[model samples]
Every structure is written in C-alpha cells, then in structure tokens.
Target: MKYNNYYFKLKSYARNYNINPQTKKYYNLDFAYLVELSKLDMYIRKIILELSLDVEHYLKVRLLNDLSDNSKEDGYNIVGLFLQYHRNAGADIQSKADKYSFCSDLAEKHLDEYKEPKKLAVWNIVELLSFGNFMELYELYYQTYPSFNYSDYLKSIKFIRNAAAHNNCILSTLRKPNSLKKFSKTKKLANILGKIPEFRELENRDAMMRNPVIHDFVTLLFVYNDVMKVSATKNVRNKKMEEIRHLFCDEDGRIRKNKIYFEKNPYIKESYSFICSIIKYIDKKNKNPKHTNFLQ
Candidate 1:
C-alpha cells in the first residue's frame, strides 16, 4: 500500500510539470503525459533493484556455493546501495515471488510435463515468460515490431532483458553489469550491415537466458533496473534527427568506436545510443510543448 501510494504521488508530480529530471539542456516539457511514463520508469527502477537482491540470495545460498552467510554479504554491491538509499521496497518476503508468479506457474506446468529441469532450457521457456496468462501474451508477441522504426531499439532492449533472465554471470553477486554484451541471448545474432555487427554483438555467439521455473531475486532486479524510464521529446525519428545537430552524438571522426569490431559486445553501446536519442527527443518535447505554460 505504501509503494502504491508513493507511485501514485510520483505520477501526480510528473503530471504537474513540478519536476523534470533532465538537466537544463533541452528535452523539457511544460505540458506532458507524465503519469504513465513516470509510473513505467519507477516500475523499472524498482524491478532492477529487487532483481539484484535476488541474485545475491541465489549465489550465497541456493546455488550450493561454499560461501557462508557471514562470508558473503550480498556479494554484489548494487542492491546494497539501492537498499540504503531508496525507502521504497516490496511489502513482503514473497513479494518478488508474487510479482513473478505468472511466469513461475507456467514454468511449473511446463516442467511437470517434461518431468525434468534438464529438458527445459532458457530458450525453451520464452513462452513461459509471458506477462499475464503467458500463453496469450506469447501468441501475440512479435520479435520485430516492424511498424515502429524504433522496433530495432525495442529489439535491442529485449535482448538485454532476455540476457539478464538467463545468464549466470548476471545472476551472481560476484559478477558486475559492466559488459552489456555479456547478457545472454536466445540464439546467435544474424549479421546486419552497419546497423549491427556480429563479433561485437554478444560476442556473436548463441546463448540462453536461464532455466528453472523459479528465479532468484537477482533476475528481477536486473530486469527492473535496466528498464529505464525515458523522458524524451515524443515522436522524433531518424529523418528528424539530422535537423538537430546538438542532440546527436558528436562522433566528429574521433575514431568512431561504433566502427570498431565490437567482437566482444554491442549491447551497452547500442542501448546507450538509443537512450541518448530518447533523451534528446525529450528536450525537443520540452522546447515545444503543445501548451505554453508561459504566455507565448
């Protein structure tokens, strides 16, 4: 109830234009659709923090690791900091479990059918990861929503989410979120020209997210944390991007790292670029809000 109230209050704040998280640059808005977007951002931040805690718990106890309770203090510092700063938290111990109950239930049913966890690979479980009654969600899901130019942006993020869910490195407190490419993937990525390169993309190898119907806290934490709320100028595309020189990255032939063989990973770089563009768009929104708070 507290978190729910808090979430709603934050939603109100955004709607009033009382708080614009952005710096002075540009993507600001006097009249903006803040409620849904703010809620979404808050939801994601909460998820990542929660998932980090889950990861620590799994590594210290569930995985049969040698570390003892005293020896390992949530090995990863990510949650430790989050827990320290944010007053908001899930109400109960099982709150995380409850949030993911749908996925777990589907996992159980599927696992029961197989009668063995070994048979259920991470890739095999995407159907189970559906949001609500996962089956219906899966039926309508599309890998590439081509209708939206930013479909590719969504695709890149989906890959990161899948990676966080499946990879052990992501789950362990011992591991860090430094390398975006390290996140697991369903299969080897196909090479697309300049848009995406193979070697640097998740190391250009196929991988699975993770198996087991039940997930540790870390999976949820990573998912929530990584899903950032973007407050960008609404409705800007590649064609419009050229007109605004300031918003674009000043690559200026300074050895475009993007050009280098990202043989190791492109997840972070790709995702970062997308996020920056969104931020720029937000500036545009701020500059030209449909309603002028101050008389024109």
Candidate 2:
C-alpha cells in the first residue's frame, strides 16, 4: 500500500497503457521461457481486471439504491447500522478506526450536521469496510430483497479480485462445500451448457466448478443479472461474448488471433471461451424469468 514515488509513477504509466508493470519490468530475453509465460499471465490478469470492475461497480450502485430505499422507508442510520454490525460481529473497532475514517473525514469537511453519519457514496463507504464487513452489509441488504442470494457471488468475487489485484495465480483448485449435493450432471449447469454449443467441449460440470476462470465468470454473470438493468446486462453480455470470441478462430478453432507460435496460449483462449459461453447462456436465459437459475 505504501508505494515509493517511483513505483507510483510506474504504476500510473502501467494503468494508462493497461499493462502490469511487473509483467514488463521482470521480463528479459535471457529468461525467454519466463517471458513467454508472463505474456499469458498478463492477458489473464487483464481479463480479470475488466470483469471485476464491472461487477464491483454494478454491485455498489445497486446496494446504494437499496440503502436509499432503507433510508426513505425507516429513516435508517445506514452508516450507524454498518458500524454497529461490525462491532457486534467482533471486528476490532478501535484498532481499525483509522481505516473507516472516511465517514468522519467527510462529515467534518462537507456536512453541515457534522455529528450525523456522513452521507458517503456507496462506493466510498464500501472502501472503508473490510471484506468481511462488506459481506455483512450486503447480507443485511439481501434480507430485504430476497430474490437472489448474492452472498455466494460476493464471496467468490472477493477471492478472484484479491488474487487478480495482487498478481497472484488464480488457477488454484476451488474449494466447494462438502455438504453441497453432488450431481452426476447438475440440472442448472446442464441447462446452461445446452445453449452454448461452443463450450460443450467442457464435458464435465465438476471440472468447470474447479476451473477459476469459468467459475468466476459464471458468478459475475449471476450477480450482474441481479443488479444491472436487464437490457444493459444483455448488451454487456454480448460485448463480453464478442471479446471472448475474438481470442480464437471460428472455423479453424485456433487459439489466439495473432497466430504467432511463440506468443500463443491455447489454455487462455479455452478458458475465455468456456466462460463466454456461460455468459451467452445467461443472456439468453434472462429473457425468460422462469428459466433463470440463480445457481447458488
């Protein structure tokens, strides 16, 4: 979190170019194999970043709207409610006080009634909460609107986001609940896959559950549909599908559009396509509410 001025400058440069500085700076021809691996790694990071931004923005906005409703209905002290929840949840309030000070900082700087909880924007308020606190806050919101249980989606996204943001490997095996029912073929998953012929190659639903890229994308689509405007979600899904398809050939089924033998990574494209297919299915399913499976 404490970046030197030089590191900050480089990070800004990397952001402007949409590339990770670690990918560029750590690579040299002497380590040719590593250089090649880094290229594939950078591309996966890029996709994760893009997807996370959309999910985070949509969730924050939706939660803000719900908070606005709660405020209007009961004059709820939303900020106070969050503080109390964290306190009761055994969060070290005094120790992490500084991290949550955006409320106090804003109150003093802008609000006329400085003693009142600051009318912080949802995105700003979320930044102040630890991930655990955020989940608690989200669960409170979910209680009122019980249509989709977004707790699982948020948990899954947090795992993916932390790994992606920290430049950690996301290809690790997923740990699912042991109590969750095992299915030879999940009805929800089978129905989803039935629509996306391109990804029928992913024969095993179990494998998809274990695959981070596929798992993360499916979670994103579920939450995206829940929060975003239906029409907007459709358009977003289409755009994502188009981008995924661009990574490979339609006819020859060759991975990586560039076709440079040295730079191509087939696994990357396979994962991308597999996820894109699910998004496509979700988009189609959205048109009919009964068919929409909020696969928890």
Candidate 3:
C-alpha cells in the first residue's frame, strides 16, 4: 500500500521539530509510533470535526425550537450561559475567544454571525463551549431528549481528543508491544459500561472495548447516530474503519465471519462490530419517521 495520507501528514508534522545542528543530540525518532499516532490523530480530528458540526447544528435547531424568540439577543444570552459555565470551571476564556474568532473569520460567509457580538455565530458559540459545558446546556435546555450522564461521555471524548490534539503517546499496545494486558482490561471496562439495560443487548461488547482508541470511536458513533442520520453515520464510520484497517493492518488482521484472528489485532474488527450493533439498535428503535428529520 502507498500509505500516502499518513505519510504526507506525518512528514508535515515532523518538519516542525527540526533538530538544530549546533546543539546536536540523540533524537530517538520512533517513526513507526509517530506514524501510528499521526493516523490516530487524523481519524480523531475527522470524528471531532464531524461531531462538533452535528452537535452545533442540533443545538441551533433545539434552541430555535425551545426559545420562542431566537433573536440575536436571545441567542447571545443562552450561549453566554455556556461560556459562563465553561469559564467557571477554570477554562481560559481568552484562548477560547481567540479560537472562536479565527474559525469564525474563516467561515464567516457560511455562518450566521451575530452583529451585536461582532463575528459571533451560533457555531462560534458552541465552538467556544467545552464539551462538558455544552453537555450541561444540552441537559438543562433540551428537555425533550433522553438525558444520560453527559459528563461521563464528555470526559472520555475530551480526554482522547486532547491527547490526540497535543500529540501525546496514547497507544498502549505500541508502548507495551509484547503484551495484551491493556486489551484485556479494556474489554472488562467496556463490558461493565455496556451492562446498562439500555444497551445490554449490544453485541461484541468485549471486542468493542479491546482498544481505547476504538472505544472512543464507538462513543463518537453512538453520539453521531443519535444526532444525525443513522444510516449516514454508520456508513461514514464503516468507511473510516476500512481506511484504518487498510492503512495499519496486514491482510491477516482483517475480519472474517464477524471475527478477527486473536493473534492478529482484533481492535478494528471489534470496533466495527460494536458500531454496527449500535446502528442496528438505532434502526430498530427509531420507528418515528419524524425523528429522522433532524433539521426540523
């Protein structure tokens, strides 16, 4: 395989850390680990970008539905609550504002920018809000939706996101190459979480939790499926999984008969099956045709 995408992105990131000739020192360049990390970061960035867009869209609809008058003032006040909540939790509001300004400027024509706040759009509002704060707003404002522990889900999503964004070493298997200890522990934790009656029947629970990265992807799939088209989200997920498998795995690592060879890494197979299970569950349960129209 050419590995064009991973090759280019990793090379691009590598350019930033050039070693100075004057202060030459041994640089243990783990090319393989760096490639893997790059791949994980690429996939996670896509997932987070998609999820953020979907959540922002949903919030727009939810706000318009919940608030009788979604004017510039009403929208600003409601979104201010999210910013305040995040600020109260010790987040640097100034940094967030900078990001908001940058993304908003780039996406100015497409976004519904608020004149009063000068480049503040609905997307910008949600963009500045942390996942935890956004979840708080979701729970408090969106009363019609079934509320789970948003904080728990937010923690997992944000933790993995920050690790990838900051280029942290997140691959347990890569670090501890010879052992499957983390894999086993992941399975146990997944099974315990999946035991909830709501998803008790979720298949391949053990396999789904075999890898931490895969588990995070599953969390993303669940959220995307709920907020977007079930079929579309599932298809996007399957496509990404296929790309990852081809990029990172040998032919032996591929799934057959809904199973991966234990000797080969089963994380991809388990993760795919887990996502498929959630998609199936959603399809079965979402009987209301009206629910499919998320924009409405």
Candidate 4:
C-alpha cells in the first residue's frame, strides 16, 4: 500500500489526528499509529454491533410480551392501532417491506396475505421494522403504557448502532472535544453509574460522557445490563465483555497493547478506564443478584 495515498484518506476523515492545534505541529502522528487506531476502531465497532443486537432482540421480545399481556385488544388490532397512529411511518415501513418481500418470507406474508395493518400480527410488524423504526414504535407504546422512559437512551444507542453498522471510525476524534453541542447525560445512566463507587464523582462521570463515542458506548452497556434478562444472553454478555477487556488490558487491569499511544492521549486512556470500570461493576452485579436491580 502507498503511504501517501493512505495518509491522504486518513486525513480526510480524521483531520484532528493530523495536527495538534495547541502546538501547531503534526502531533506525533504516523502511519503505524493510524493503523493501530483503525484496528481498535474495528474491534470497538464489532463489540457495539453485537451488544446492540442483543438489546434490540430483548426489546422486541419484552415489548411484544408486555403489550400482549396488558392490552385488551388482540395482536393484529394493536398493530393496526400503531399503524393508524403513525400513518406516514406505517406507509414507509410497508413500502420497504414490499420492496424487499422477495428476500423475506415474513415480508412477503405482510404484503400479499396481510395487505392491511389490522391483519398483520404485532410481532410480524416488529420483525419487519428496522432498528430506528422499532424505536419509533417503542416511543408510541411508551406514551400509552407509561413504562420506564428510554427515549433518550434509545436515541443514543441508535446513533451508535447506525455508525457501527455502517463501518464508521468511532475513535477518529478521541483526542478532540465535541464541538457540535453539549451532550445531555441521561438520568437513568447517571443513576446506575452513581451506585458504582468508582464513578460516584460528578467530574468522573461528566468527563467520560462528554466524549460522544464513550457516551454512546456506555449507554449501550447500560441498556444491555438493564433489559437483557435471559440467563443465556447474560452469559453471552459476560463472555463478550471479557473479550473486550482482553483487547485493551490484562487481568491486572494494565494496558496490554498501544501503551504509549494511550498514554499520549489522556482522553482515550480515561475513556478506556471508564469503560473497564463499568464492565467490572456490571460483572460484580451479575454475581450478586441482590444488587442487579439497577433502574428500580
């Protein structure tokens, strides 16, 4: 591979990594460091994608079960109501379903056999919807059922989910502060982190959440811990969390690889420590069921 061509491409996406504004120099940037960063980003994206899928599956099962048990109406009727409440979104979902029916047997049924929303089952409607569309349905359900408000958290997860799914670089701006806007920390996340002694300090929590990537990644962990109830999935989460730990640190919680790279960037190191702390907190909670009830 040509170094200049790859450097130009990297600069196009990660301009902040090209130079340090404080010193007005190249900021110790090099192709080898850039390659390691890309490798780290790829691992992070895989972790996010796997965990987000777990959350999405759990959300679908939990929501559908709750609605079925509580609502007086049948599944088809409830789906119809959702469609009627959000007609444009419903139309768009149906259009996409029709366009891709050839690939999906469920979509084909939704189009050919159950032409109207009233004839389609709630689970089927949910199965056909994308993650973003599913969140819209979740919001609509929340308005009526009045459960724990996950709107803010869901939005953050959606942003990260889409980015990971699209193979975007998550750590391009690790050293740069977010200049777009101030991120509003979710109360539920704050409450959960507050229980852990390491994250009890306001400054610690604020510093971690200020970075957009860290914020979303932590939110994903929060949702996974709070909603994923099945024992099997919990086991999967534990295994995956351990894998993430191995990627950056060892059993003694020491940086394993790219030590100098993380040392030079305080924000990146802090973010890594913050994530490890949360994972450790969660692992402890998982051991003792008495402390596992986070949001309650």
Candidate 5:
C-alpha cells in the first residue's frame, strides 16, 4: 500500500507510534515497525481465533446435551421455547426475520427436505446457527437452565472473535486505555488472576485489565479454563490447551518469534508479559495434581 493510504489507516495510531509525545513533533514512522506490529496482531488474532473456536464448540455441545437431558426429549421443543422467549421479549422484528432467513437457507443447504425451525433437532439447530445466533440461544439457555453464569463473559469473547474473524488490527491501540463508557470487570476472572503470583498486586491487575484488548483476551482464557473443567471432551480440551500454552509460553513459541520488534513499545512488552504470566500460571495449575479440578 502507498504511504498516504497507510497513514490514513494509521491516523488514530500516529500519536503513539509516529509522533514524539514530549516534543509534540511528527516523525517518519519506521515501515518495519508497522510490519512487525501487523505480524504481532496476526499472531495474537490466530491464537484468539483458535481458543475462541474451542470455547464456542464446547459451549454448544454442553448446552445441547444439557438441554436435551433436562427437556427429556429430542430437544426440538426448546427451539420453540427459545424463539418464543425472544418473541415475547419484543426482539427486533428485523433481527428475527434475518434469523429466519438464515435458518431457511441452512435447511435448504443441509436437509434433504424442508423442515420447519420448530421441527429441527437441537443438534441440527445448534450446528446450523451462526456464532452470534448461538450466543443468543446460549444466553437464553443459561438463564433457563442450571449452568455457570458466564453469559456476560460471552460478550467479550464475541467481540474478540469477530475482530479475529474479520482480520482486524488488535495491537494498534495497545497504548490506549479502555475507553469504553461502561465496562464491568468479571469478578471471577479477577479472583482467579489474583491468585497468580504475578497479578497478586491490585495495581498490576488493574493496569492489565484497564486495556480493552488485554481484558477481552484474559476473559477468553478465563472462560476457556472454566468451560474445560466440565467439558465432555476432556482429551480435546487438554490437547487444545496444550497447543495454546506452547504457542504463548514455550521457548519456541510465536511470542518469542520476531521478539525484537516488541522491545521499543513498553505497552506491548508489558502486555505480552502479562499474558504469558497467565498462561504459565494455567500450565502450572494443570500439572499440579492438587489442582486437578482447575482446568481438567
């Protein structure tokens, strides 16, 4: 891309990367720095996408199984119940119409014959629903059924998942604090992180969570750990978690690749250290027999 086009995209970031804060003078930004930053973002996004898919798949499987067990049926009835709940809640008509259209398309593509949404099996319905739609279903499922109340965490996971899925630049705003008007810290995650030696201090925890990207990524780790405890596919969870741990915490990991590029930015360096600490903590917890129930 041309320099002007690149600057256009980097306008919001120029203050942090291209200008001297104290001197208040613009300087020529190193193109190599931008390349490294993009590569780092891509690496982070790949990790997030991998773990998010694990969370999404296991969540759907758990929800489907639990709904089937509780309903004591093929679980088709719950679909109607879910739709009815949304309908009674006065969900946007357009949103419902869009969902209907999506389901209709899925039915056409996957089913040999047309089946009404109500007639679709729970697994089929869940398998067909997009991640966003599955979240809506999962939200209602969490409310109506007995489950851990991590529905709130799903919003952050969804945000990061969409960013990764769309190839959005995640590290561009690492230096910026969380600018969200209304952000709530997940107490469960905070408590877990507090137990980790690195985040023992309140200030350290606050500093890390104050950045939105780090906050969301930490939330993903929290959810992934919690879900794996009760996950039916323990082997799969173990394998995936190990892969993630290797990627971020291992000596030959992606984080260690192109390591020099991160040295100039304190925010990026600290953020990487913070995340690696959490991953190492989880790895330790997994290896200790006493904490067998932690992420197993």
Candidate 6:
C-alpha cells in the first residue's frame, strides 16, 4: 500500500499532458509490457483452469471418485499428469521430473499461501487474475514456469483476460468510432459464442449484470470468485486504473488523490477474454480441429 516518490512524479507528468489517465503511462514500454504481461499471466491462469478441470474430470469420470473424495493424492496425480503431458511434448523426462518435484516441494513449502483463500483458487485462474491482475500475476508465473506454452490459445486470450481482470468494460483503445453499435449489430456474436441464443438474452443479461456491479460490491465480488459466470463485465475498472495512474503519476510523478499505488495491478478484463476465448476455442477444436472459429 505504500508508494515511493516515483509514483508522485508519474502522476504529475500525466497531468501536464492533459490526456486521459488510461492513455497515459501506457506510453512507457515497461508499464505497457506490464499490461500485456498481465494478459500472459491470465493466459497462464486459463491454462491452469483447463488442467484443473481435466484432472478433476479424469479423476471423477475415469476413477469414479465422488465429491467427498478430494484428496492430496489426487492433487499430486494431477500435477503428475501435467508433467506427463509436457514430457510427451518432446521434453526431457528427467528435467521434467526434477521440475515437478521442485513444484511439489514448493507447493508444500508455501502451503500457508492458500490458507487465507485467495480470491482465486490459485488454480481457479479467472479469479486469481481479478485480484492480482495479469501484469502482477504473469510476472510471478513466468518467473515460475518459463518453458511452458503447451497451448496456442495463450496469447490472445491472455490479452482479453488481463483486460477483463482489470475491469476494462470497453475492451480496447483500438475500437472504431461506432464500435458499440457495430458490436450491437453483431448481436449474433454472442449466439456464435453461445453467450446468448439471441440479442435479447444477451442485452438483458448484460444489463442485469452491469447495473448491479456498478452499484454493488458484494455482487461484484461474488461473480469475481466464480469463473463459470455469465457476467459481461470486462474492462469496466480500467477507468479506475487510468484515473489513478494519471492522477498520481502526473508530469513529475507526484501523488495526488490516490492514497495507495497499485503494485499488483489486476487486469480482470484480460482474464475474462482469456477464459471465454479458451472455452470457445476448446469447444470448437475438441471435436474437430479444422473448423473455422472466431470471437470478437
């Protein structure tokens, strides 16, 4: 929560430029990379989510374990499977075994890290991105897992995931002048994405989810913890980050209104887009890899 002097200097520089807070600091390669790196971290989260589901399903369907049978051995088996998959990808098994062994050792070493119940299951992904955002999370992940890119969905989905993680309800700065209307025109996009059967359902649900979130914090927190939700909230909180950034990191980096500088900037929107896109991509490809599929 404590900020150094550079935060105030960044705030002043941003103010003198008279640009919107969101548009500032983005000019810096480090922070901008941080933004994208945030997405990459959520990309990592998305990857973990599928693994959790796959591992859990493998246990339940294949091993026929019920809800009451959740065990550490099962968790270890899941990690074992992950190591197996990576090994099959032409990875050196000795290297892989050593790696997972370290992870196992580390997971036990930091068992208390999960005692407080992080916003995400650490394994749940989408929720983890919400609190820590992509930039903060991904840096940790990359520092942790450097040789993994087992899925192609990592890049773009990570971008959207970071966007959602940070609450950028509007998605991007690259949108066209009539982007909302254009997206409205593509009401079928949701149907295509299975977000809704039609525009009516999509709009209705979006409105239902949006208003309450803008006005309610608990509801927002609830949905935040649930990755399988239908909330259309992404990029909504980018405005908050933008405002805080420019307000504090102005022309000379002088802190102003913000009492605390966000060290763990969470880009929830990026996480959203990430999980959504992954769900869509996996659905289409799981059955047939050749089918042409796209999401906006």
Per-residue accuracy of model 4 over 1-296 as CA lDDT, tens digit each: 36433554355335445466788866656656666666767778888998899888888888887777875646676666677777765666557656755435565555654554336777778877878878878887777678765666898898889889997767776667454376666777767677767678746677677677788888888778777646757777667666666665574433447667646655566777777777777666767766555556
Task: Please tell me which predicted candidate would have the highest TM-score against the true structure.
Answer: 4
Of the two candidates 4 and 6, the one with more favorable lDDT, higher being better, is: 4
RMSD of each: 21.1, 9.6, 10.4, 3.3, 4.6, 16.9
Worst 10 residues of 6 by lDDT: 213-222
**TM-scores of the candidates in the order shown:** 0.21, 0.57, 0.46, 0.84, 0.78, 0.23
Using TM-score as the measure, name the better of candidate 1 and candidate 2. Answer: 2
lDDT of each: 0.30, 0.51, 0.46, 0.70, 0.68, 0.30
Q: Per-residue error at 53 for model 6, in Å?
A: 18
Per residue, candidate 1 scores C-alpha lDDT tens digits across 147-263 of 211112223333334544443222111112334354332222122211233223442122112221012222232222222212331233222333322323455422132323222
- Show where candidate 1 strays beyond 4 Å: 1-30, 62-64, 67-296
Task: Find the number of clashing residue pairs for candidate 4.
Answer: 0
Off by over 4 Å in 3: 1-45, 69-100, 103-133, 139-152, 164-212, 230-263, 266-296
- Tens digits of per-residue lDDT for model 2 on 157-274? 7766776788754432222222134323234544655455555556654466555545665665566555554465856755664554454334333334333432333343345556
State the lDDT of candidate 6 residue by residue for 81-128, as single tens digits.
Answer: 333333332122222323565333433333244332112232432221
- Per-residue lDDT of candidate 3, residues 110-224 (tens digit): 3333422333434445554555556666654444333332333444455456655565434433222222453333333355456646557756665445555556655554554
Q: What are the runs in model 4 whose C-alpha is more than 4 Å off?
A: 1-9, 12-23, 100-105, 112-118, 177-179, 251-255
List pairs with backbone clashes in candidate 4: none
For model 4, what is the error of residue 268's alpha carbon versus the real structure, in angstroms, after optimal superposition? 1.7
- The 10 consecutive residues of candidate 2 with the worst lDDT sum are 9-18
Give me the displacement of residue 68 in model 5, in angstroms: 3.0
At residue 59, candidate 1 shows an lDDT of: 25
Two-way TM-score contest, 1 vs 3, winner:
3
